[model samples]
Target: MSGQNAVREFTAQMSVREGRWRLYVALLNTTEQWPEHRFGHSVPTFMDRTDALSVLGFAPVPGAEWEWTEDSETPDDPASPVVLIAAIRVCSWSGVSV
Candidate 1:
């Protein structure tokens, strides 16, 4: 349970607000271990992928890698097995961890 290896999973969504793409993200707490977990935040639109990562607090550098795996299920449907409108993994940078 070392903090260094801890991976934070998040479910992200992109929507147009004020005619610009914005990012909303929620922490995926599978274990329910943290009762204080909160809902996602509405982040402002970013200039680029690097800017997006920086806004999300992942100081992404050159060669930094991440992905947005599509989730076929509808996020509004509770019965859906997956809710990944966009899935992102917070991995160590230097920048090649998934």
Candidate 2:
């Protein structure tokens, strides 16, 4: 399968404001291929590096164009260390079993 059609994982780092906007765009971009595309119908999740490593078993893969974010003040919510949002593609094709 071509890269566009192939299921893959992507990670983006952004502030809360930017992250929300990205989520919106991803939803729009993948709507036509809902459940088929990586971002299609996918609720992108925001996670910090630490949680991603420990809980999600994430490892850094190359080839992502990093964007610099300006640190800004946010409400006091320590539980929300969501700097990294991962967009992972999923494909399920059950072939006929003989």
Candidate 3:
């Protein structure tokens, strides 16, 4: 699949949670098809509504303004760290904390 297509698919799979805050998490494949290439690396990234808007590079839809924050914790092993991105809804989607 093409890189753009892959990204689109990843975005489509994002799920939104509702309660105190509404957020979405999506795993992104940052690497190209060829592992030899410098861009051929995959990592999971989380995006809230605002982050998603920034990524999509356009003005957000009406009533879709929300803020998100990223939380990362070091693993007990110390060798690995757990990273998380969460979207925290602020007044009318002012900004994201990530």
RMSD each, Å: 8.6, 11.4, 13.8
Residue pairs with colliding backbones in model 2 are: none
Q: Mark the regions of model 3 whose C-alpha exceeds 4 Å error after superposition.
A: 1-57, 75-98
Identify the leading candidate in terms of lDDT: 1
Count of clashes, each model: 0, 0, 7
Residue-wise lDDT of candidate 3 within 14-48, one digit each (tens)?
A: 22222122223332344322111011123324333
C-alpha TM-scores of all predictions = 0.35, 0.25, 0.21
TM-score, structure 2 vs. true:
0.25
Local accuracy of candidate 1 as per-residue lDDT tens digits, 33-95: 211111234433333544555555444334434454545355677676543333343332322
Residues 19-97, candidate 2, lDDT per residue (tens digit)? 3433211223343322121232333443433233223333334443334443324446665544543343212222101
How far does residue 41 in candidate 2 sit from its true spot (Å)?
29
The positional error of residue 75 in candidate 2, measured at the CA in angstroms, is 20
Model 1 TM: 0.35
| Best-first order by lDDT | 1, 2, 3
Measured on C-alpha atoms, candidate 1 has an lDDT of 0.40
